[model samples]
Target: MSSGPTGQPSLVRTGAKAGLAFAGSAIKGGLLGLILGGGVFFFYLGQLKGPGNTAARAGGAGAILALVTSPPLLVAVLLLLFVVVYAMLGVQRGRTKAMQHLVAARGEAVSERLAGAIAGRIEAMPRTHGTLQRAADWLSVDALSKQLAPVLGEGKAVRSVVGFVLNRLPMSDMLAEWQEGRAAHGAPVAAEGAAQDPALRALLTRRINETLQEMSTPSRKPLYIALGAHAVLLGVGLWLVN
Candidate 1:
């Protein structure tokens, strides 16, 4: 109901923000690992050379250099790899959440449009005359299923409506099935003549198909953000390893 230019941020902007936050967290984690690893390396080096002779000091220094340049560095690289994996997962989760939010926002609009379209179609039907046509004209979205019951049957009408409204979206099947199940448990049985009307069902399906086609806009901003985030994370990880 609330339509404003600044209602919510766009999906790409949200995803970009999420990516940056994940990158920051991952860099901090990598730095912390490097610090802890370096601390342990230095602690062992100090332990290797106590108050001893110059020969012992020389040997300890050699050992420290060898350890630092080899196994400890390798461990640091491995830690960076772990961080890279963690960052990737975090970014993916963030992107998925952003996509869900975008779809939900769009879906509300689609539902409203679909409801108005269907109600208008129902009222315009030549077969639906007299009081039924008047009722359809005044039907609210909440009462649409009930109004449709006389024409399309109770269970089939709800499923048909839900499927028509949601079938093109990502979670369409899930939502339709949930609505159908909910309706089956509580909706009243349809009039005896309801099942004979295929015209209304066909009309609803056609409208949905048309709406879906209209909704399909080509946008790759999310994919670009995901790729860019991965590249940045990989670069940071490699830099940390070096």
Candidate 2:
């Protein structure tokens, strides 16, 4: 894996990008839902005014308040739920793309022995409990472990190796730098200190690339199914209301 001195592929960076994309989708969907729901509410309110003065007879303000607080708000909330589900699916798709890009950047796989050796070296280094244990735990690689368990089998050793890479090693700094570069063009680059440590850099890059490749696969099918179900429920609700 030949990352530039300043630019390394990182799961953290990929995740950040996915999160931002989801946020944008959510904001757009929410605004659209608000507009549509408001329009429906007003149209119904106007129609109600014409027929038998039903709204006025029912204590005008109370009827209007009830209408505003009920159907329109409910629709808006349902639409928001739909939007969140779709946006989550979009994030999954974005993650797959980001993984593919990272895998392509690496071009070839680094050997398992080499990766293991680097991991072992990092684990042997002295470090604070907070930095090593807690920091590794923070990466939430256990989520990855859960996903991969059926394929890779369950083991404490696997978890340890993951923790070593994520917490004990210098990969976090490289990942941080990658995130900075993504946030701004021509950002101040990370120093060449990591680049100088070829073994560490190569191992970190391989782990990140391999992890991305694995995650990019068909494991996200469940998310798509859930999103579809949410959309269907929203559609059914709207139809019933209409």
Clashing pairs in 1: none
Compared with the true structure, model 2 gives a TM-score of 0.37
Which candidate comes out best when scored by TM-score? Answer: 2
Q: Determine which window of 10 residues in candidate 2 has minimal summed lDDT.
A: 188-197
State in Å the error of residue 124, model 1: 18
lDDT of 1 by residue, 95-181 (tens): 444334333444444344454445354434444324332433343444555544332334432343345444443333422443365
RMSD of 2: 15.2
lDDT (tens digit, per residue) of candidate 2 on 1-242: 33333333343354456456545645554554345444444444343323234453476686556546555334444555554554555555554554444344332432243243444444444454434333343344576445434433344533533443444445566445444653576543323222233444454666654654565453557555664665565565455445
Q: Positional deviation of 213 in candidate 2, in angstroms?
A: 2.3
Would you list the C-alpha lDDT of every candidate in the order shown?
0.43, 0.46
| TM-score, one value per model | 0.25, 0.37
